[model samples]
Target: MDNETTTTYRKIIHIDMDAFYASVEQRDNPELRGKPLVVGGPPEGRGGVVATASYEARKFGIRSAMPSKKALQLCPHALFVRPRFAVYKEVSQKIREIFSRYTDLIEPLSLDEAYLDVTDDKLNVGSAIEIAKQIKQAIKDELQLTASAGVSVNKFVAKIASDINKPDGLKFIGPSAIEAFMEQLPVEKFHGVGKVTADKMKKMGLHTGADLKKLTQDELTGRFGKVGKFYYQIVRGVDERAVQPHRETKSMGAEDTFAYDLTTVEEMNDELDKIAQAVYNRLLKYNLKGRTITLKIKYHDFRQITRNQSFPFPVGDLETIGNTAKQLLLASGIDDKRIRLLGISLSNFGEAAVKVKGDEVSEQLKLF
Candidate 1:
């Protein structure tokens, strides 16, 4: 098939649950409805982050990944609650069932968001926009929750359109409108362009898609590395990536940036205990075991390094993960270095595992 014909006939939709964790909390509890809600660790703790915030809390500048303390400072009255991943996962399964009724081609980015290719839908819904509407309505009717959807020719545009009108919204960006739509989008809004990259782009006077389009492909690649090629095509509303329903989980890991650098071995080990437990929980959730354990460390000056050990047999126990990570840390010679960030990851699972897309820029860039 020709490129235009190939692009024109494709139907992709991106569905994102609005403030998923916070919304689920509000849905289950009448008191949290309409009130600003923060789902994550409580503000009373020293090192807790916000997992998600209700729309009402978002109005006060609270966002996912912000410190719970900062979220509280933004809106002192906002209620904080811990995340119930098991409950959220159960709800996510029901959401996936809803999507399966329309199309089997589903790419779940997380528990709360996914992409569906309805080019050949099971229900014979010829219109992508109509399918998106039906899916949104079904989620509302069946689950007592709201979802926003974006329908377009490809994944990139569809994902961005999904966010234009959030919390129960549907937007369809047709093939003809894709060019103009992409050109006007802010650089920061582009996927894979994080705060650091966006700041760099703005300082270079590249503030919007139009500004980015002005640069040659070589210029972009030279300035931004390999991902610059992605920027070049995406700025013109071109994304050819197919939605892979069975994207392999090459690795699973978690990392944390500290509020203050750790200057002692005891302090660093304490942080590793927390991080390793998190990794263990995730491994258990996916029923995955890995043969490799990697420890990543970032110094106070931002110099980062990784140390990993591979075993003949796969392991997932919390004790093994924690001890291995701590051993890796001490073996790295941290006599005089102050550390600001630490991470633990497991990889080389003997078989395929489901991948949960992470918020890290490095991980997001790998999708392209």
Candidate 2:
């Protein structure tokens, strides 16, 4: 490579808090510590699910987004509590503050995970590993929480490295070592490979990065569609995306997986109404309004469909959410299909989050 065209490797870090919401609840309430605790809606409530669970609860297979009723069946003595978004957001802010002390290139994937570009450390820390160590220490000392950090030359490798060691684990993959690292990774562990895709890849005799490398880019693309191009490069330890700071939330919405299937329009409508209200409330909280509304329905047999409509202007009202979702569901012609899940979301954010009403809501209530 010419001098001007040589690759300039960047030091990137991905940090993920360990069971964040459940940890916060455990920290604030001493009585909940060292026990199987779940943070989310009560199991008896309609559409209840586990938002997150402590490591203790996870021992019994409790997990984030799992149905709380199933979680109860898995661990009968598990304590389930409603989520306190305000508290969790506060902790998230504190975590971001700590990151800012090291680098401004911070992209939050959620309240619990973030990616930081520390190619030039603000603290003048010579090593990215040291910077990660300081960040993990700060969270432990200040917030009484643990975070896993993954460090590497690029975002893709760094993200995978971070999960290698969980619940306060740190791993680093250097540029020279990344290729060997990628070759050993399972197909399911790649960024875009879900369970279904992994199964398909297995059937194709591609179970590892090495197996995938045997296929040419054209062949992979032919088999996996557009994402195959990504796999072709990533299996070679190449990902050129930067760590963007202002990664905006493209869409915001609420969804629910019902405890029982709904076969009637009345039951489905009632459920959609609740979901619309939840979506509307979130829009207000985020100070976001969108021109498009999307409805998602999952049938009892696991078939799913999504329908969307765009208005000429932005909408952030309860009526619009409920009516638009109901219309879409009806238009979908569910007929006698039993629905197991329903969701409503707003998108096409051409505006910023703002105060929708004249009354001043507390800053503590602000969530995005």
**Top model number, lDDT:** 1
CA RMSD (A), model 2: 5.2
What is the TM-score of each predicted model, taking all chains together?
A: 0.82, 0.81
User: Model 1: residues >4 Å from true position, as ranges?
Assistant: 1-7, 254-288, 296-306, 312-323, 329-343, 350-368
Candidate 1: tens digits of C-alpha lDDT, residues 214-306: 999999999999999999999887899998787667788878767677999999999899888878877887778899999999897879999
Candidate 2: stretches off by over 4 Å: 1-7, 41-47, 256-287, 296-308, 317-342, 350-368
- RMSDs, each prediction? 5.1, 5.2
Task: Give the C-alpha miss distance for residue 311 in model 2, angstroms.
Answer: 2.1
Which numbered prediction scores highest in TM-score against the true structure? 1
lDDT of 2 at 57: 95
> Model 2: per-residue lDDT, tens digit, 8-106?
789999999998888998998999999999987678845477888999999999887787789999999999888787678778888999999999988
Lowest summed lDDT across 10 adjacent residues in model 1 is found at 359-368
lDDT of 2 at 356: 27
Query: Which clashing pairs does model 2 show?
Result: 287-353
